[model samples]
Target: MNKNFNVIAASMIAYFAYRELPSDRLCRSAGIDKGSMFEDATMISEEKIRNLWVNAVKLSNDLLFGLHFGESLQLSALGIVGELIKTSRDVGTAITAAANLISTITPLFRMEMCSDEIHFVIKLLPTERYDHNDPVCGQIRDFLTAFTIHELDGLTLKKIRPVSVIYPADKSNVPEYERVLRCKPSIGDHVGITFEIQDWDMPIITSNYELQQLLLQSNATVKDRMSSEVSFKNKVTNYMLSNAYLGLPSIEQLSSNFNISSRTLQRKLSVENSNFQQITDNVLKRLAISYLKEGSHTLKEIAYMLGYNDPSAFSRAFKKWTGFPPATYQRNEEH
Candidate 1:
């Protein structure tokens, strides 16, 4: 539906911590407008959110930026979603609430939960594919895992350490993982956090059934409002945003998903004064800018993600879009 993230999680601490680094400059470097963050109900591009993490790490020179940022996060930072989790009767219910409300809180990723007799595993999958070697992605994963543990402990009033925190082998912050997680972290194929099964049933100290019911109603209202406001164009763009990682979809493919003929889809888009090609170009432009700004991936890597068969072709496309080669654009942004 808009492929956005609530700015509260990124901007709250950023406002105070980044005094020397103006938010406007950061937003521009990330290819987002500064005014987006100042709205009453601020919602920023998911790409901007990722770029923020990358830039924060670059500016702070902190390998543990995500872990450190998450360590200080309070329930208030998450708004109603945090409230819903805090008021749940048990840790299991809290986890469920977090899972259910994640799309409303942040549509950047999806949370998948699996449990065994001895352990419960929660895996974080990005709504789009990212470079596995990008440390910013790993750091954000670390932040989310650590933040979940921290929130659960706060609600249950116990120091509940996960059995293990697993991150991609390519992440550079190896030593800091153990320090931040307070457990031996494993380098693995999956990005997930595993906790002992016993903690799942732990009763929350702040559980309030009445308050939770009220929050649930409030959450549904928010979701409904969001759904009502999303136009068909946005729905198509959102789908493209998530699936662009695999490859950009053709008009025929997109129309098929909507159960419409290609001509019908074209007509609908024309009525909105837009077209599939324009939307695809916009998505590619945004991603190209974000990747260029992040500066971690090579031109080839970014090219592949944008569905280019060759780096030279992608470079030409990027130059046309932004009036500068990708490398030059990145260097200028750095300056």
Candidate 2:
């Protein structure tokens, strides 16, 4: 799925990491050009970005390079939504809009903000899981967490440290991490950060109602346009994943959800060299792996979640998909 992030994300990394390394070397290592990154309305691929963090952390020899990189930027660095977020009437509005508009900047990532007691939780959920194999992805997660928090503190005129953090990295007591993030990282199923609810309603210092409305309209237009660029297979898969709570829809039902006949759906999928069953199997495999990797459910529970009645059946299918059983794969990943 060619996931892309705004060029500014790459530019920020180069600008910051280069302070300790040569500019040319950093750019070459990251596979990003110094001049091209500063261009307006440009994008950088996720693979190059993976290279960026890998080299940035290795060359700088900073364990918390991602946290530092994110803390250095202001809200204005978020390409298209920079001004929009800055102009939001309040912190809550700014953050909610930022979460929803992330797809405009990077089509796959999204944030889920929910009120939990006296705190608001923000979880970064990227739709495309294809790039999760990158070793330095944990750094990218830290960057995002600190990036949003820094902007929140700036806009709200209050130091809003996350009460808890859910990062991809293992738990650590790194003092620098606590200093930068105001909390240490904890491995969780998703990328999450928590903040006090009192900070939510704080008015943004740069709130500009009229300009914000205009920016909102412009962002909506861009988001709608980008929706067209997404593949039909992706759209189907995302829909299935999103609605999995209601149970994975059948091919006919799934096509109905897309407002098309099964034949039409199959035909379109054929152009992509895919079929409905393949899409269904893809979703099942993804869910199965996710459940196992999380290590929070029993095989029986996972089988039920995947719509299988027998644990043995789920285990057999999992073995067929991979060389080992679900439990074995989970154990290997843990080690």
Candidate 3:
């Protein structure tokens, strides 16, 4: 990735268009373009995408990032529709009625129940960036934590653990997690924050007698919304790893195989939060480390596998990346 990323008010734009703010200065500071983020998806890497989100939370100073954004759009739209149906039901009835009609609001991003184990998981597609304390992410977590607690009254999460974050958390936010989640939420790690529901079988406050049917339907919709493109990226990376002996693919070859224009292919990957060169480097780096650990291939063979014609050139590059030659790394590992 170019490392030039900008923080724009995309969610605000989605909510109150007038509230949208230009991220040009932020991008300029971060070395990215503000105007082209919506169009030039490749300009934003996953880390950068997540950074934008985290910045949003900091910019807004609110935890209900997702809900606030959603309220402006989905929830607001639902309220308009709910007025026609609001007078006809109880709280539970209103909830059930809202769930069915709110699919439009819930579709782009949402939470769904899965069996007795998982309460709600964030499902977002067509989003490139995500990070801890990301206004949207924080908003979703806050909404889930608060809504779940409010709805069940007795149900409260024991702890909130974040599996991923672009940056570390401060002490102030730590206590808030303890209070809100009834458990400390871990940040900068790769484990989901778990909320233990004592009565997993408790029914939602909805008019529908068959709560299972609604949950099942919602789960199915979430599964259906998941794109298969994530798997495709893994495949491409794996292919690069195995064929390291070959030189980098020309843009034409990659585009031809994927049935897309070179530019379109690049842009699509950017939307997915990465670019070809970035993935290629990551794959190569992973494979290079593994090969070094094995210590079986000769320098010449290793060089060839990495698409370098000369051992000396490969050694120089390796030293630059890892600050050690292959022989020294292999010997240290063996020791």
Candidate 4:
């Protein structure tokens, strides 16, 4: 919500990778001013922020960079910060503690960790729209790679593997993947980040406990304020069920249907834990799947339903969403 948050969030990644990529090249490609990225605190447009993400990905060849950046920053910094907060604890409590502390610094992402006796699942939720070019995403990948190594180094985790984003056996990036994960990397059908939970009972070694408690308390208070944003998010999701395919509606039109000011709608949705873009994607994914299954509509038809004008563009998006071509999805569904 802060004006300069995107630039700062994206730029810190440039800072992190500055040695590998010179400052001038990264800044020019990312469309950021060298000095202002760190100094300017003004809120930037979503367009500019998204462009930063796009540029970062194109320049770096990292698809999941923004998301990786988001998750890793919290994991590392907050893990350290949480250490100053409390004593030994379970993975769930430690993660919660770290999450609470990290939310204070940046509301761009949140994490949920849970288990059902088999393994621990950590869900990373982005609070804002993701940019394909965001250097932060790459930072995130580096962070995960680094954190996997750190946990292994700490002797808390013996092996680190990703259930998703598997590296190809014959690919050139295999060495990089192996070095980062510190284990044999397997690429599977899963699409997001997952770290193994071998020692759910590992002990944390940190000296500060009181600071952790205070950070948790503060997080609790902020969460209460943001709860309404969740409802607004759901409502927005419901609104776009059949509408997003028509075109992205104005906030005013959407708010009018709900009988409130667009400002009030946004405020409440912020509390409910959603936003327009997120809702739009939710609806689009659903609609795209549905249209694909019907077998009557062409790719162009599906794209138009999702508010795109061309079939080629739709095909590209479909591939991105499902990791398969539209024709492949249809053929498989038919079989």
Global lDDT scores for all candidate models: 0.62, 0.63, 0.42, 0.48
Off by over 4 Å in 4: 2-17, 38-40, 44-46, 59-90, 97-112, 116-118, 123-174, 191-198, 208-335
Q: Predict model 4's lDDT versus the native.
A: 0.48
Q: Model 1: how far is 329 from its true place, Å?
A: 63
lDDT of 4 by residue, 1-335 (tens): 54434434443343224212343555566565544543446455545554555665665555444433432232223334435334445544565665564454344556556665656655545556434354554444344344433332222212335444343232455554554454555654222345556545555423123322322332222112212233335435533441232444567656543435788777766776776656666666666776667666668756764667787887887787788888899999999
Question: What is the alpha-carbon lDDT for the whole of candidate 3?
Answer: 0.42
Native-referenced Cα lDDT, model 1? 0.62
Tens digit of per-residue lDDT, candidate 1, span 190-308: 66889899898988755323222322332222222123245556656655553343246788656643445789887878888999999889878876776666566678767875778
Candidate order (TM-score): 2, 1, 4, 3
Assess every candidate by TM-score. Answer: 0.53, 0.53, 0.31, 0.39
The model with the greatest lDDT is: 2
Q: What would the per-residue lDDT of candidate 3 be over residues 171-196, giving only the tens digit for each residue?
A: 56665444433456555432233333
- Model 1: residues with Cα > 4 Å off, grouped in runs: 1-4, 9-28, 31-38, 105-108, 126-128, 133-136, 169-172, 207-335
Return whichever of 3 and 4 wins on TM-score.
4
RMSD of 3: 22.3
- What local lDDT score does residue 109 receive in model 4, on the 0 to 100 scale? 51
